[model samples]
Target: MSFEERDHTADILMHIRAADTIGLFTDAGHALMKTMYRGPARPIEEVSVTITGQSLEHLLHGFLSELLFESEVQNIVFCEFEFQIRDGEVRAILRGEPFDPAIHGGGTEVKGISWYGLSIRQEQNEYACDVLFDV
Candidate 1:
């Protein structure tokens, strides 16, 4: 799995590539947390999220949005993710610790995950997509 920051006009754009659908979701979650928090200084807590979507693209958007919600509501930053996708639904276990301003340096504050420029497709055996985040 891999993720790269892409150029966007006024938001954050990320290109995610993975070997499978679950990998795509996992990498995207990691990318979102990395974008907001530099890195986890300590792994102290874990959280789990289960969500459903109409399709793969929607699933990705929903997954990222859920991560953002967790950050805002629980004041945590996720560094690791385990994803299970089945029939348009996703079950994810996120591992990380509470965000400490003093320890975990802050990065860009992502307002929400955007649908703009969102695309997902399979090339050969790899799955890839471009996700835009409103910051």
Candidate 2:
């Protein structure tokens, strides 16, 4: 799995490529966390989220949105994710620690995940998509 930050006129854009659905979610989650928080020396807490969508694209949006919600409501930064995807639903276990300004360097405050320019496709053995985050 791999991801790169793309140039956007406003907000942040990320393009992710993975070999499977689970890998895609894992990479996207890590990319989002890295964009907002530096990291914690060690994980101190865990969060679990389950989301269902009508399609793969919607599922991706829901996954990212849930991550954003957890960050804001819990005041934490997630670093690890283990998830399973089946029938347009995702059940995930995320591990991280409460955000500490001193340890987890601050970055752009992502407001929300946007569907603009969103795309999800399968090419040969890989799945790829572009995600836009409102900042």
Candidate 3:
């Protein structure tokens, strides 16, 4: 399926009747990751996972956080991430490989989730969220 940039930014949306509860849309920014990752360019392996929720911001944070945590635990690092949301359902495709322990920050470890300074807002057609992940 061909997709055009919905906007200069990565925020994605689609137009469909409200009844189209099962619609699917893909963002170009996400499509690029299919071939390789970004931070240091690595071949992609698996690129598909689904997420369901109510708030977009919440879902996004949870999804990305889970991916990063999994990567750290499994010693897998990916540079690119593609996200798709429909009817509050999210699908993510991650591409990358497990990098050496030395590649990451010095003495860093995935602790757990945190509530400190967590925030998300959508105003005047703009949306943004901030999540603090424990190290």
Q: Look at candidate 3 and tell me the lDDT of residue 88.
A: 70
For lDDT, the strongest prediction is 2
lDDT (Cα, tens digit) per residue for candidate 3, span 51-90:
7767754565556556655565556566566666666787
Measured against the true structure, the TM-scores of the candidates, in listed sequence, are 0.93, 0.94, 0.57
In model 1, which range of ten residues has the least summed lDDT? 37-46
lDDT of 2 by residue, 15-131 (tens): 999998888988888878878887553567898999999998888899999999998899888888888888979898888888889888867788889998778889899989889
Off by over 4 Å in 1: none
The digit string of per-residue lDDT tens for model 1 on 19-55 reads 9988888888888888888855455788889989998
Model 3 lDDT on a 0 to 1 scale: 0.45
Ordered from best to worst lDDT, the candidate numbers read 2, 1, 3
Clashing pairs in 2: none
Q: Which stretches of candidate 3 lie over 4 Å from their true place?
A: 1-41, 105-107, 123-125
- List per-prediction Cα lDDT, in the order shown: 0.85, 0.87, 0.45
> Cα deviation in Å at residue 85, candidate 2?
0.7
